[model samples]
Target: MAQLTVDIIRARVEEDWTRIVEVLNRKIALQSISAKGITAEHMKRSAEFVAEQLREVGVDANVVQSHNPDGTPGAWEVTGSKIVDPGAPTVLLYAHHDVQPVPDESAWRTDPFVGTEIDGRLYGRGAADDGGGIAIHCGALKALGDELGVNIKVFIEGEEEMGSPSFIPFIESHRDEFAADVIIVADSGNWSADIPSLTTSLRGNTDIDVTIKALEHPVHSGQFGGPILDANTLAAILIASMYDANGDLAVPGIVAEDPIGGLQRDLDEATVREDSGALASYRFAGTGSLAARMWTKPSVTVIGFDAHPVEGSFNVISPQTTFRLSLRTSPNQRPEEAQEALAAFLVEHAPFGAEVSVKRGENGMGWAMDPNAEATKDALAAMQEAFGVTPINKGEGGSIPFIPELQRIFPAAQVLVTGPEDPKANAHSPNESISLPGLKNNVITEALLLAKLAQ
Candidate 1:
């Protein structure tokens, strides 16, 4: 492999800027929303589009399909490779080709399917969330060309927006084909447009459904309301037990904090409140810095509830009620264990001897990467050089289940999560975008990291 400096990589990425935008725009034009109404052929087209770009950059790419749990056809997956040397370390790049459903087209300033550039940022449905990711991989490969020192593998799935139901089966069926020594997941966002970041940790998630039954059937509220509270009231008690007066998760056996030092930086309360769209008078929950509460601590939210609506006069006492609990565990805790603990808590805390039943939903494990590893140092240096600023390690409050699954399947591989999306990217919402300069910098950073691994 020929030695390449960061300066040369930056210059090459700059030269390919126009082509990168063109590719991103073309990708944006394809509405690959993997939802209920979308068809298999529609998804296959997006996968083939990505494969075509990879092939153009000298990668042996193909659009493949994985199976669902019932042995039915699942979402399309694009897998490809560029092996420079059998002896060199292989790096796997991951990003999704599908996007979230646009709930309201009228909210968009520009057409969601047409990539628009305004004040140096490209706006579109998939621009930053993941289309930017595809551009990064192809741009880096194109810029480095024959100078790319390490082996490269690309896995761009078409079902990430739908929770990647086929991810486990897909990976298990082709474990060897996706093997690598290093993995870069370009699905997360940086701190800001100018500040680069690497996501070192992610909170795992588990969902549980609980039903509380107080009566066999509905009875007149006037007769049963006083002696026995309605099932909905009993359900409220169970939900309130999840938190203490401090608003911390009241469950036991679930890890609460990082156990190491928490976030390196704390978020401003006002800024977080404004960004989250919380009412000014709404007091924040949980104890500790906003960053720790959001990134490292455990949280339980009642995502769904079943009860009588307030639209009509309800003169009868409800017999049963059900609610769904979405639990976000600490970065280092196992979601299965947390789920068990939560189930036990709900059963034990059933108020007024209400008959409670807990049903386990799905779970995804969390992840925490070693920040001092050799590849991590290289990545940090690459980001520093590309962005001309010090890089920070960040922890995402949300779960990217597939990432930890990849780490579990390939225990020897180093997983690094970084991307061009910023806080203003508005991913999954109206006016989604990516900074053009940030996109170029990410390409240069990835190219430099690929080169640094060679040495």
Candidate 2:
């Protein structure tokens, strides 16, 4: 803590690239997709693999089991621990091994299960969010050996992508096991490939499934064309009502909080275009700063639909239409209230008195960290020292539902969100990747932060 040499930390990461890649490669090879696999057995095996690796570095590592609220098997948590001093605060290293399903199989430049490197970027489904994180945790422990400034715990989660259904329950059951003064979540992305960022806020998420029905059975389009109303059309109209001409969510009572003063930075158009795959001819939706629109506001997208197949001959008015909606809410917005307003809008505005049912799916509240907290400042200073650049306060558009729960469990603990993925990492999408530089630099940042926090 008293003295930190940049070159030494840099060399530590560089020298361990072989083992790092090995850990990540093994994790990538495992299809621990919690959403698709209800039992999550793959998660348990993956956690054991990580624990074995952590044990190689003298950490007391083991796999802990916890169940989801519905009694299903939740993600397995791999915990590795060491204590340099009993008095110093413990630092919890957090990340997940579960990954999102590939959007399109043909879109992958390389096998999604095989970790491959091209032009200095590792390409794979969970390479960045957060197989890379697993590597970083192992690498950092290997570097630190038994000389850590404070006690350290590495927590590798298995059900993060499934919105962490049982995270609250697990945290509550193992309150003493998770005791720590600071938490560093490595499931976030940086501002860019070259820039560093500290995620200060995360937007909450809610899923709403709606089904509209007009008649019990379909009627011939030609026979009842003028008089009969199709459920698909009514559903479409109600969906369109969610947005105004300006493209912002027009649903009544949807909350949008202002960006933290002096913390917001409007993303540049060129970067947004490249990162978002937006074409020049396409117009941007929503109002206000791009950062605010993405990070702190409510955004909706139609994620699933049940309708007639385009290739199938359907010359009949459909009797029912079902759709799944995903809503990202502001940090402080009440999830149930927003869901109630949205359900009311769809049912109240149903076309021709069509029956509409909006079923609320899983929901998670967002979190805002105190930027000026001592642990945050210590980690910020460590990041700047590691990269030779000042890291900016950033808000992640994605949701880590357990963050708010973790805060509730440890109200006095400081949470600092950091990760290795960049904008081009494309997490939760095809060709998800992490650059060599970013991977090494972020690991060094975490290692340095742990040391400084011990001080």
Candidate 3:
């Protein structure tokens, strides 16, 4: 790598910092919630906005459309300036434009759809998790359009928060256009406010709905007392069997060992509990290293329950009960295998005379990247030059279903993950925000990366 002037890059970032923030806030003001999955209108508006920005920078930009599995129109891709050499290694910059829905408006400090800034933080629904990241990439491209002399493509998805169901099909249909030597996913966050990090792995996820049935109809408790089999009681027993006294998962086939080389050093237990808003004396399940249990082990959560409330309770035995189960599996673990393990456990341990039924939903695989790849090295170097610090290799517990698909299609490409969020970004929660300093630094880093990749 040739020696680059750091001062020049910093100056470019500062020159356009305010404009970048304005663009991000403006887009946030437009509600493009894709929680129920991406609609045709959402794709259209996002594509137009991105293309307009690229055009303003004197770069040729266009959108490529694809269809969903239901034969309905799906997402659109925004591709920027092309490379002179067709065989030269190309880089793809990826971010999702869609955001999760804000169901409870009254819970937020400001309008969830309206972007607001206070105390150096930009507050909005998608400000940190994704929208802010997209802005950083666009700002970087605009600032270094001429200096970054390589082929670059920007593929923004419209259905990431909804599990990216249409993204795999889109990639399959446009393999040639999406092909690249390196893919940078600006969707993850740093370990802390000052600690830079690169996410190298993500956990897989699966969901199941369990139902227990006892009788055909509800019977009065006065007449059937001590004789009727209560569905609610059976459901309680089954759920209780999922964990042991130590709070560790008691199910078979789920690995619970410490991770290789241990976990992150700054992952304090207090901070974890505080961030998750746990009770004052609450404790996490399992034992051993925190990172290992979270990133490399399996975790089960009871997401929802269907039952009669005490306020509306009648003196009768309920006929049915249902609950939802969510599982997070480690990298290299098979979703099918985990699903089967959980199902078998419930089947064998179900209470006597009670029929237990389990239904599975869409399952996605986990991902782990090669940290020593050339593109990753270049990205790290570029980030170091831009931020004046080295980035730590890390793993994320959340899953992105489209990542595994992208790797499958472009088997040889390196995937680099980093973004503008820190530990306090509060993505997916009330009052979500992004730090202005973090956004500006990310813009500088991405611009430097473009120039480095072109070299």
All candidates' TM-scores?
A: 0.96, 0.87, 0.89
Output the lDDT of residue 15, model 1: 86
Worst 10 residues of 2 by lDDT: 257-266
Give the residue spans of candidate 3 off by over 4 A: 1-3, 35-43, 104-106, 110-115, 213-229, 256-262, 352-354
TM-score of model 1 vs. true structure: 0.96
Tens digit per residue, CA lDDT, model 2, 1-455: 56656677778778887888777888888866777763456777877887898889778988887788887766787877887778989988888877888757799989998989999898988899888787777777777666678788777887888877777887788788888999888878677766788888888888899999998999999999877778878888889988899999998898987664345467788888887789899989989888888888899889999987799767999999999998898987867777888889888988888899988997888888787799888877877877788887688787877888888888988988888788789888889888877887787887787777877
Q: List runs of model 1 lying over 4 Å from the truth.
A: 1-3, 36-39, 259-262
Tens-place lDDT per residue, model 3, 33-131, is 775546657656876786777677655778766577898876665666556457656888888777778889898999887888888888898898788
Report the C-alpha displacement of residue 93, candidate 2, in angstroms: 1.2
What would the per-residue lDDT of candidate 1 be over residues 333-369, giving only the tens digit for each residue?
9999999999999999999998999999998898887
* Count of clashing residue pairs in every prediction: 0, 0, 0
Total clashing pairs in model 2: 0
lDDT of 3 at 352: 73
Cα lDDT over the full model 2: 0.82
Per-candidate Cα RMSD to the true structure, in Å, reads: 1.8, 3.2, 2.9
TM accuracy, model 3: 0.89
